[model samples]
Target: MRRAFPWLVLFLLCLGLTPVVFAQSQSELDELRREIAELDEKIDAAEAEKSAVAGDLAVAQEEFYEAAEAVDAAQVKVDAVQAEIDTEEVQLAEIELDLDTFKTALAATEKELTETETRVVDQTAELYMATATQAPLVFEFTDTEEIALSSAYVDDALGNSAELAASLEGLRDQADRERVSLAGAREEQQTLLAALDEKRGRLQTEVDALDEVKQVEAAEMGELQALVDGINANIAAAERHKDGLEADSARIEDELARRAARQREEEQQNDGGGGDGGGAPPPGANGWVRPVPGGVSSGFGYRTHPISGARKLHTGLDMSAGCGEPIYAANGGTVVTASWYGGYGNAIIIDHGGGVATLYAHQTSFAVGSGTSVSAGQVVGYVGTTGYSTGCHLHFEVRLSGTPVDPSPYIP
Candidate 1:
């Protein structure tokens, strides 16, 4: 009976240890499940954001094209107007040359008229002097033949002078009229040239204004394009992140499943051996709570990576919380991991029993240590912009059966 007592004590200890081992396995599975959920959420968010940005970028590019077209059209009009102005200027130059010719001709005509008048005046003056000096002698001594010849000479001279004066007066009048006509033509030509110049100026102004508008529109389009590019980058990053998370979650889930199966089989063996096998632990009484009391800044899903420009999955919910803000546990659980993790930065993972778990990432500091039990709404860490984070926030995740699932359903 004494030897049987020692064997009984050993059996009791084994029975007591069995539940603890099972619980630990379950916690690990739950944590993996939570991680998967968080990754899925991140991917969804990134995809949506990328889609919106792409649409905007398309519009911007369209607008930019339109602006370019406008600029081209305006340039064409400017060219056409310039051509017209050039033609008008050529006509104006021709008219100006014609005017100069007319003035020169008029001046020559006036000079010829003045010379004829001067010659007529000189002839008349000579005839008058000859008549005064020779009239008495000619009348007293001249025979009939001589008188007839002198009278013929005086008549011929006077008649020639009168004819020359009349011709000169007609030429002068004609030349004056021609000069007036040419002046009128020149004035008309000048007016036409001015009108053409004014038209050209207006056309040029219009072109300038259109060019300015085109420039402004082009700039706006460029800005829109840049925005679109940025969005595309974000989408790609999101997708890559999502893929990574999915792979990680799958691997972890498989490991947890294998561990769980082993735990179950061991329990079955223990039971068959007549060991006291405790029943499954009860379901958690505490419901899920938000890790941070803040709006979701980045949703879990595929998004463009900001730095790498790659499509990646984001595997967690980014809460818009200030740095150093307390992060609470989503449910009562034992801390599975509490340490600096690559990209997660000061992360803490909690394992609630029954294949449920939650993760808190990018924490400035941790309040709880690994293996420590935590209650729902217990402060587990503080928010931070650490390890791949753009700003201060809480990256929260939930898992079920070691597979990541959306935390929204579980978060309040």
Candidate 2:
């Protein structure tokens, strides 16, 4: 009877262990199911992010095309105005040559008139001398041969004097008319020169304006190109992230399935086992806080560049702050980049897991290093006016799957 009692005690102990083992298996199964559900949610979020990035890329491409076209049109206008200026310059040169010719002709005409006046003065003096030296002779003497000869001599002298005076007078009138005509030609030349000058001025002004327009257009095109490049980079990064997420989800699913199978087998093997277990904590929250405490000096969207005056996309928020002001991390993440970046100055980029990231730009100094872990509100850098910044401020950005999105919603 004592040996039978010992067997019964061992049997009761085995029965007590069975439910504990089965309860442990059930707990494992529930954990796997929760993990699978989280993976499914992550996949859905990744898909939506990809779609958004694609749309932004398309908009950026269209803007680039439009900017290029504007640059082309401005260049054409500049060329046309320049051409008009060149034509006007040529015409001005020809007109100047014609004016020189007119001036030379006028000088010759004045010289001729002066010479004619001098000749007339000399001839009049000679006629006066002849008349003073020769006495008035009356042809009353009865000598017919002498009378006829004297009469013929006097008549010929009178006829010669009258012809000389009349020719001089006609020469004077012709000189006066030539002078008037030359004056009119000079006046016309002056008018033409003034008109040509005005035309040149107008054309030059147009050319200058067009040149300015072209410069602005060119600047806008360059900005657009940069924007397109950024969008392309974002798209590439997003695609890679999507692929990674998908792979991760697949791996997680496989792991969950394996764990579920193991749990089921364990439960079947220990149908009499019983236990209680706890589940893991839920996934981390998805959101961000402001990197700096200040009002936004510049908002995200298209705006005219203050320095370049070109319309361009402002991809991030510019928080106004004093130089050397501390900049905080927006969320918990691993710093992927911490160094000088083109146009961004001393920039820092953090990967916050689940395809989320944040950027801090134009910093005077860095407080964090690459590959270092950081927590929300941790100082990562200082505000500065480095690189292309117009003032001391923090350029904060939030990226979902590497695509820049408006950071306003994420900020508290």
Candidate 3:
């Protein structure tokens, strides 16, 4: 009964304080559950905010890259235009020199024409005086008395002296000999006048030919002058375009700097890692890449045209690669062109400096864009027909300066 009393007192003490502790524990558990739910909500909200910011950053980066590429293309276009201006300037200089030369020649020719006209007038006058109206007077002397003028003169005029005395014992034989000599002199003078006329006509013909040449030069000078004017106008236009590009480039630079600052701050917040790196390595040991891993269908040089069976200039090497095969760069270079080229379809051109360039044609799609620096053996595009091709093949070209060279010489 004494032990039972002690147990009862202990149970009462426990029962009296147990409910308060249990209630306090339940309140703490509920508060902890509510705190956990709030934390999860905050986490979802933070993740959404991060995703939106990242999207904005990605959009800005894309715009920056596009703007940069456009500016680069504009710069290249401006450079080409400037080069054209330089070429035109040189042409204009040569034209000016030619114009000066032609002008001088024209002046000399005009002087020659005037001299020829004067000579023709003078020669005509001289010929008229020498050939016309001067009919030689034939004097017929009729004498009634037949006197022996000279015995020796009469003998010379006759066939023989004895024959002459038998034939004519008068001075009639001497008069006939004198008449023959005068006729010979008149015939000789007329022959000389005729020869002079022929020479004058030939000279006038030469003069006329020269006059025609001068007229052609005068017409050519007019054309050259017009071309020079057009070239100068183009030069002025190019200068204006350059100025506008410069201003645009300055604005772009300012924007790029601001974007870069923002990117740096964002990077500090998120740490490293930005931009999806999408560039290509260049060609190296494999100087020549298989355009389509197929047989060489045609070589670069003169050959029979497949369509015409006639001799033609084969501008490039043709390979029988399958469609959609990766087209790699033959050497280390930058992609200078990636667009539809004449006869080349969807083509890609790489500039390997030192005035060397290579071309890949008949592409389905390009893996890289213009101005992208590439390494050897890097895939730049895929093979397909998009130009003047009859089949799925790659048209490859090796160029020195701007002239097509034998690709076989460089192929590995």
Candidate 4:
């Protein structure tokens, strides 16, 4: 229902009713007022529904802003967690490179140790065979020549052999120590790498969760923004309707003023003595009667608006009448307006001579049409809760040359 307001506003604005001429009769004037009133009704409806939606739109916009902020915060956390993961990965890569280097060194140390052991085994075997051969010669030799020859061979063979055996033993021990140290270093690197991998995994999990949260918040923000846009469009439609209604009302009022002026001029020319035309009930005069048989519910003056809660002139006296109750004319006059009249729903306006007029508003239906001359206490309409009224009642006003005055002075 709310979405259709914009199209309705456009259609009404395009109507472009013909302009009113000065010589148009009271019936033509009433038709114009009715048309304007119908337009006003549409405008008022659009305005009436806007208040609730506008409030909703405000709340939605606020939520959207909060959601957007939450998304941004979540993104920040995700980025931080990802950064930590990246740092851990880099450390892990370094540890892997160090492990590879340590393995290479261990392979070379083991190969050198194996070669040294092989050389030591070969030297030990040569020494044992020489000792065995020389032992037999020692037992057989009683001559000094044999003894000397055996001794010379032993010394020559024994030269630096013991020292070489000692040096090989030291080399083997050094290789064993290096292997232990390398193994420990590799183990330490592996342990550190495992810890970093675990930390990175945790950070990655955190980042994934934060990303999901951010996506949800962003989606919510998008929905709220769409709602706000829709509400703004509704408000725009209402504003357009209001503008059209004002334009039409101004035209009607100007026409009424013109007609009133013309009537007064003609009356003055005919009287020639500048008589009062037997019009305009003086102060404390008994020229007008009550329009409705009810007590006053509200008196005319400045008061708080019931619907809008703004300070404005009440503009009329509210008579406590029930729905369908007959509304009488305040005095005898021609009906200048008997149609929907802006905030005064289903209104009737009677024009008495001497610039005095009376209005009755918020009627369910009209008893008489425009240009109809009605006598005092004549039923012009039935009470209704139309226009700006809260219930079935008659809004009575007395105007002097189109400006509303206190109806009390004219009603007695």
Candidate 5:
């Protein structure tokens, strides 16, 4: 009988463990939750890094694109400058050729004028010397001829005649005029050469300036391209770094989740409280408090996210209700928070005792704020779809410590 009594006691002890195993203690759950929260922080940091990288990438791409455009524009300018230089060079060459041709023509004309002037000078000298030497003889012959009175002497009477003198003077005058004309033409040609040279020099200077501009533009383009390349590299590096952070965060989160799951499993195994959770309800209470009375618009599971258009599992249930519907306190507790939450605009949180908590999200307005105390069924807020939802609804969640659980069991 003593042995049977011990067996009964052990049996009772094992039975008592069912509820204990069903709910983890606040301290142990909080520790595990703290680890999860730390991992969540890591994930958040990783996401922030990733977002920064994305921004860097966008800026880099924009700069790269602008730089590429500038490079192309500079290249076009370089091409244009090259063409202009070529054209100017050709024009300079043509000008030079023209100057040379004109110079050669002037030289030829000068040569002809010099030869003609020399010929005229020689003719005049011969005529002057002949007349001088013959003048004295003529004077002597004229006296003899007058004494002899010959018929041929009459023709010789007109020695050093006006016609010969006049012709000599006229020839000299023509040579002088030819010399003046040739000299003047040579001076004109020289003036033209000087003008052409000046023009050519200016053109050359312009070409040089264009060349310099091209070099500067090309260099600037190269530098900008390098900057763009560096920025792109930085963006890539930042992206990789951000990805690493995200992966690290994910690993930590996975490890935390795995540890938590293992702990939960171990607790379940030690107390033989696996999936079976049916038990006697808490006594002295009419029933479980309804968190918020509303029709279920969406249940827990996969659903299309309204904003992201992504297929994601709904972590909790969505309650269908009108906008500004008076939201009630799920259970008697203090308000943990009532504020806007990301993707859950105008949210409220209620903390029940023993680490039990409830979240009401997508509220049009709030009736309470953080630190406010309230009883069950007290109006806490108004309900509406404010973020990441298709219609007016309340996103409700039940958690033990920081871990989510099915709300249906506690609701009824």
Candidate 6:
């Protein structure tokens, strides 16, 4: 066991300061407990906040993913619409090329038709003149065979003109039909192109909208994640602080435990060699024995003060003892005082029930408290040099009716 601080014990006994010291210690312990409780509350609050923030962060992340998926879906739709637009554009280009071909053919057919009509009109006029004047009748011919040949030639000429005119009309009709078909195809393609463009526009709009939503949700996720981090940080800090406080509390508790254990040990050691009527040493003439193993170094009478250099009544016998050596009770008695008294630092007084008391002073520490019964040879305290002392020893005294007397008559 560690030795007690004798000076501290002396100071405590001297000025009635033990209770104040203990009260301060108790107050400190209580403060530590209160701070620990408060820290626990803070930690709990921080954990709750962290949990809530984490939940929000999770929700935000889920929403972000959903928005990203929507964006992907919208992009796919836009791509599909663009593909349709490209196809429609190709078809429209082909229809335009067909329309141009049909237009050229129709124009050429109209020109041919016009030229054939003019030729037919001229032929009719020529034939009418011939009929009116009968210019084709054998007047232009030298013989009947020549006249027959001319009539055959005129008939072939009229037949060939009529056939050519009819062929030109049929070609015109065929070209007109092809031109109408090409125009219908071009119109349908243009209509489809316009519708595709409108659909692509709407799909692009949807894509842009979904993309915007995705951006917003992503940003929210970031903020919520940051919040979760901050909350976790707070919780971690609270836990660390709580741990520190708990460590301090544990230290204080350990100190208190040590003190209590020391106290119990001291009590057992002090009471070990004694009972009220048993284990006592054989008493001398007045039921007393030597209080310490160290015999008397100075007797109880005035010669000169060792510290003051003046003659005075020495109140006790200075018994030689090493520092921290136990001082025994001279007889079975009740302890009347176990504290400091003036120049007698860390002293004890025991009354033996007949206006007779024994004093043991300048002790390092007390083994028993006041009002305790002790037997002869039972340990009362350890020796020390305190007030008005030059070295470690016990100042032993015997008192009768509150007056100090020589202790030699009482102890052997």
Better of 2 and 6 by lDDT: 6
Candidate models: Cα lDDT each? 0.64, 0.61, 0.55, 0.65, 0.57, 0.71
Ranking by lDDT: 6, 4, 1, 2, 5, 3
Candidate 5 worst ten-residue window by lDDT: 1-10
Q: Rank all candidate structures by their TM-score, best first, as comma-separated numbers.
A: 1, 4, 6, 2, 5, 3
Q: After superposition, how far is residue 285 of candidate 1 from its true place, in Å?
A: 20
- Candidate 3 Cα outliers beyond 4 Å, as residue runs: 1-288, 307-310
Q: Score candidate 6 by lDDT.
A: 0.71
Worst 10 residues of 3 by lDDT: 17-26
Q: TM-score of every model? A: 0.50, 0.38, 0.31, 0.50, 0.35, 0.46
Per-residue C-alpha lDDT of model 5 across residues 318-404, encoded as one tens digit per residue: 876775456677677889888757566568888988998889986655666799987766767756554444556688988898887
Best by lDDT: 6
Candidate 1: residue 25 lDDT (0-100): 34
Instruction: Report residue 102 deviation for candidate 4 (angstroms).
Output: 5.3
> What is candidate 1's lDDT per residue for 1-412, written digit by digit as tens?
0011223233223223111111223234334333434434444554555466556656656765776687677667767767877777777778778778877887887788888877876886787567758765656655986678567766767697887877887887887787787678768767776776777677777767767766765676666556546545544554454455445544543454465446545866877732111221222334566677788877878988653467887777778888656677777889999986766756899999899888898765666689998877776766765455556778888878877777776776
- Screening candidate 5 with a backbone cut-off below 3 angstroms (N, C-alpha, C), the clashing residue pairs are none
Over the stretch 27-75, how does candidate 2's per-residue lDDT look in tens digits?
A: 3323322233333333344345445544554555565566556656655
Top candidate on TM-score is 1
Over the stretch 304-401, how does candidate 3's per-residue lDDT look in tens digits?
A: 86533559889889988776566777777899998767457568999999998999997756767899998767777767665455566789998999
Selected candidate, larger TM-score, 1 vs 6? 1
Q: Higher lDDT: candidate 4 or 6?
A: 6
